[model samples]
Target: MSVAGVGGFGLGRPRARRTAERASRKVARNVGVPLLSIVLLLAVWQGIVVFFHVAPYIAPRPRAAILAVTQNWSTLWPLVLGTIRETVYGFVIGAALGLSLGVIMAKVPVLQRLVYPVLVLSQAVPIIALAAPLVLILGFSVTPKVVIVAWIVFFPVTVNVLDGLSHVDQDLLNLARVYGAPRWRTFLQIEIPATATPLFSGLKIGATYAVTGAIIGELAASDGSSLALYQEHANSNLNTAAVYGTTMLMTAIGISWFLLVVGAEVYATPWQRRTVARRTWRRAGGESDG
Candidate 1:
């Protein structure tokens, strides 16, 4: 091969190696740091329990919490499944309604004027305060829990969607209008895509809140088989380890649900991801060249 070919091969190999190194570093940053932090946290927790001679009922050690989960897995698994179902149902119903309302309000000035204040006022009333009334009216059933979750999710989704819609570039919109693009066509093509990021931001926030809403709803109602119910039982019985384990499970569920939303967002907006990756690569390449 010519000297040019040899030089090209040398450069290509280095670039490939750099790319692999970057990818590995990214993975380590994402996964390794979190794992290390958790291990450190557990160590500190165990140390505190041992050093303080803390009673198990007041503050169970990390091992005790893990034991609680393992020992009660048969009972806990059903409760976890129940809570997951409630969270999904609530998130779907809430997201749909919020998106619809946000779109309608954004498109119609009259609707915005009439409805925005009501929406703001609705959020002013604490969801926990309404829990008892909802239980009384809807009874201690899944319906009430679903409604509570929907209520918690609706505000964030609506507000983010409205913010997204409002921020659409006026120049782009005017250009579309000047080009004789139909309002609906322009909105479908331009407005929706432009707003996708903010809308998903809202959805992610709602997803995080969904499980908490379900838990709160369950706690408000007396009879139910959910993590919240299990927690309440554990608290009453002074099974602190079980209470901690239930909490950990709920937190894991919430994180999983949030990540699912993020995955959906990434899938739905491939262009956005590509754009981000390009910018990141450019920045990295520029730094290296410098």
Candidate 2:
């Protein structure tokens, strides 16, 4: 083999090795650190309960919470499913309405001036304060719960989508016009793609809020088969382990919804991920150089 070929192979080997090292480091930073932190937190929690002889009612140990979840899975699973269904329905409805309104407002200054202030004002009245009224009006059913979730989700989605749409590059629009592109074509090609990241950001926020809203609605409606109802029962009975377990379940649901939104964003906005990766790599390279 030629000396140049051997030199080329040597350089390629180092590059591949460097890429592997970077991937391993990223995995450690993202996964390993969080796992270690959770382990440490559990250890501290267990130690505190054991050493202080704390009553389980005050704060159950991590093991007790885990046991509660395992023991109550038969009862908890149905409630979890119910909450998930409500959340999904509300999120979908809210997102659709928010996206439509945002686009309309962005396209029409008159509508934006008329509607934006009303939205802001509506938010000033706390959601919880309206929960009882909603239950009264919608009856003690899933409708109120779904409405509450939709209401919680609507504001963030609308605001983010509007901001994204309104901030789209005027230069790009002008260029499209110069090229004789129709408004609809330009919007499809440029505006929607640009708005995706912000839209998903709003959705992620709404996703977590959706779970909270469903719980609040359930509490207000006194729904017997919901997770919130289960938590309330556990609290009243001084079953702290069950309460903690239910809380964990709610948190898991919210996080799962958030992750779904994140996954959608990553899929929809590949360029955004590439841009972030480039920035991360550059920053890491600079740190190494320093």
- C-alpha lDDT of residue 167 in model 2: 93
lDDT per residue for candidate 2 within 130-243, as digits (tens), equals: 899998898988898899899889889999999999999999999999999999999999999899988998899899899998888888886467899999999999999999
> TM-score for each prediction?
0.85, 0.84
Tens-digit lDDT string for candidate 1 (1-290): 35556555544432222366877998899879988998998999999999999999999999889899999899989888989988999999999999988899999989999999999998899889989999999998899999989988888888998889999999999999999999999999999889899899999999999999999898897485778878988999999999898888998899999989988997787776353444533454465552
RMSD of each: 7.7, 8.3
* lDDT of candidate 2 at residue 72, scale 0 to 100: 83
Q: What is the Cα root-mean-square deviation between model 2 and the actual structure?
A: 8.3
Q: Which one wins on lDDT?
A: 1
Model 2 residue 252 CA deviation in Å: 0.7
Q: Give the clashing residue pairs of candidate 1, or none.
A: none
Q: Lowest summed lDDT over 10 consecutive residues: which window, candidate 1?
A: 9-18
